[model samples]
Target: MFWFQEGLCCLPTFLVVWSSSTFIVNYLIALFRRDVDVVFPYISDTGASPPESCIFGLMSTITAFAGFATMFARYKYLQRLNEITGGVSPALNKAALFFAITSCVGMCFVATFQETAIRIVHDIGAFIFFLSGVVYIILQTIISHKAHPYGTSKRVCYIRTIFAVVAFLAAFPTIICAFFVKETRLHWNPEDKEYTPHLASAVSEWIVSFTFVFFFFTYIQEFKQFTLKVNTELLEFK
Candidate 1:
């Protein structure tokens, strides 16, 4: 009980600190750049210039953290379920583990390249994450359908199909955002002889936003399915 409480407490603290640090770093970048009007892009309702880092940073951070947290919690949950159920589906368990590992690696990349061209790599990593998830679901669906023609509920099968569909759809926006977002180019303005922030054009903002929404839905769907499966099994045993 105490360990669970400690783990829960650490989760929020990690989220807050990481989020605050990212925001402050972005704020500093904005302060130093004369050409960049705002740190974030979408916050300007009054034609105000976008911030140096948009709310996407915050959203991404939250999403990534939530992904990692869900992965962690689900790992333990699945392990315990496997033990209770005389070993849960190995394929499903392995898929969850792979997702968790790749998600963490993606998070590290994002954090490490917050303000550099390397951030583009993070987008590529994200695309891979989506693709991997889609593939995993498709494989799971095929295997489940074959192994348990009538053992698993139709609802479970439907959920897996939905996961693959959504993930594939989401991958497109992520790819667009990765390719379209302008890289920040450092330039010396001859007039002032000072370095300036030449932000990439604003076209990619919508792509980024759409990708966030898509991934958020993906996470919610997976989490819901996992929770439902656990609950159903527990109730059946009871």
Candidate 2:
């Protein structure tokens, strides 16, 4: 059972652990180096400087690749399930896959372009990641509902719907409040006028990131029931 899809959980688990660890490590490093505020810094803020930035870039790149694998596996799994169930929404599945892939590409951009280096490009990447990621989960929730109690369970569908809703709730504020802050300061003071908006946006970003990790965690159980297979055919040359 080498191809037993239960092992697919490792990809998401790796993503969750690796990304979370990357955040925590960078946060501590930036805090200790006095490179960022003690209160709360944007994840990118923690990775803006030298030593920590190196770690952040390397880890985030790997995280992005892992994300790609996880999404592709899920896409193939659903496609196979739909075939077996005679489902009518292949287009929906394809749409979900597209958004997921696009989000991963955004993650690469986030990793490559530091906010301090090219602020606009970095922000564009973050925007794409958050927006596409939220849409992907929402679409997946819809797909789960469409699958019903046959291909998937009511409980799983409800859980995914909740995660999707939470992600949307968080992502909106993360993007909106970010625009209100006029300056990007590594060390933020509580009394600063932009502090409130900055805090709101940073907190929202963390919430969205953690929600994405948990949402991927939910895929573990569902993945256990299936298997992935690749077939090769040799053709005669004329």
Candidate 3:
């Protein structure tokens, strides 16, 4: 509990680090592998690469662990929002927190069931995570706008809103390329051939992931003046 409180504030920022670093590390590792190239888009266990698969699992574990702590911090933001809004709706933040945790759990599923390992579970997890992520962003943006206490100004919320939209909008290109593009390629193995990930899809995926990271990073300003104590589960923005 003490440790959770002490490190809770850094979890979201660390997520940006971990996810981005994982991408770089996994990409570099893939560069050395004979199976895939730097151009692969289905980055999150979408293809058959061992280290990349491991990286996906690692990312899920990382998200869940960090999310466990950061969710509390996120809840506090909502609580403060309630305070500013005269406590008009008590359940809103709670529901938002629930969705945030659900998103983390989805990441866990994606991690545990890599595409090659369990396609059905992987697909389900991906869907849940995607939906949860978008909703979480929407909720957080609302909360941030309302929780104008501490150093969180309306301007901060506005900036966050823009980034959140960027993160959300960035997904469209990837989705479109995924559905419409025919990424057919001859297999390295003469016995078999299959469709590789499209370049547009991969590039769009990068954009989406990077924008998502930036969107979360906007919360650091909100968390900057916030503090939490373990013994009482108390949080305050000084």
Residue 96 CA error for candidate 1 (Å)? 2.3
Give candidate 2's error at residue 45 in angstroms. 0.5
**Candidate 1: where are CA atoms >4 Å away?**
1-55, 111-116, 133-153, 169-238
Question: By descending lDDT, how would the candidates be arranged?
Answer: 2, 3, 1
- Encode model 2's per-residue lDDT on 63-114: one tens digit a residue: 8898888889888888888888855398998999999988988988998999
Error of 3 at 192 (Å): 14
Write the residue-wise lDDT of candidate 1 on 117-212 in tens digits: 454565555555555545544554554454333335566666656655655565564455445435433332324322121122222333333333
Q: How much lDDT does each candidate structure score?
A: 0.46, 0.87, 0.65
Full-model lDDT, candidate 3: 0.65
Superior candidate under lDDT, 2 versus 3: 2
How would you encode candidate 3's per-residue C-alpha lDDT over 4-62 as one tens digit per residue?
Answer: 24434477778778877766776666566644544454666333467667775776588
Please give each candidate's TM-score: 0.45, 0.92, 0.76
Q: Which sections of candidate 2 miss by over 4 Å?
A: 1-7, 233-238
Clashing pairs in 3: none
Worst 10 residues of 3 by lDDT: 185-194
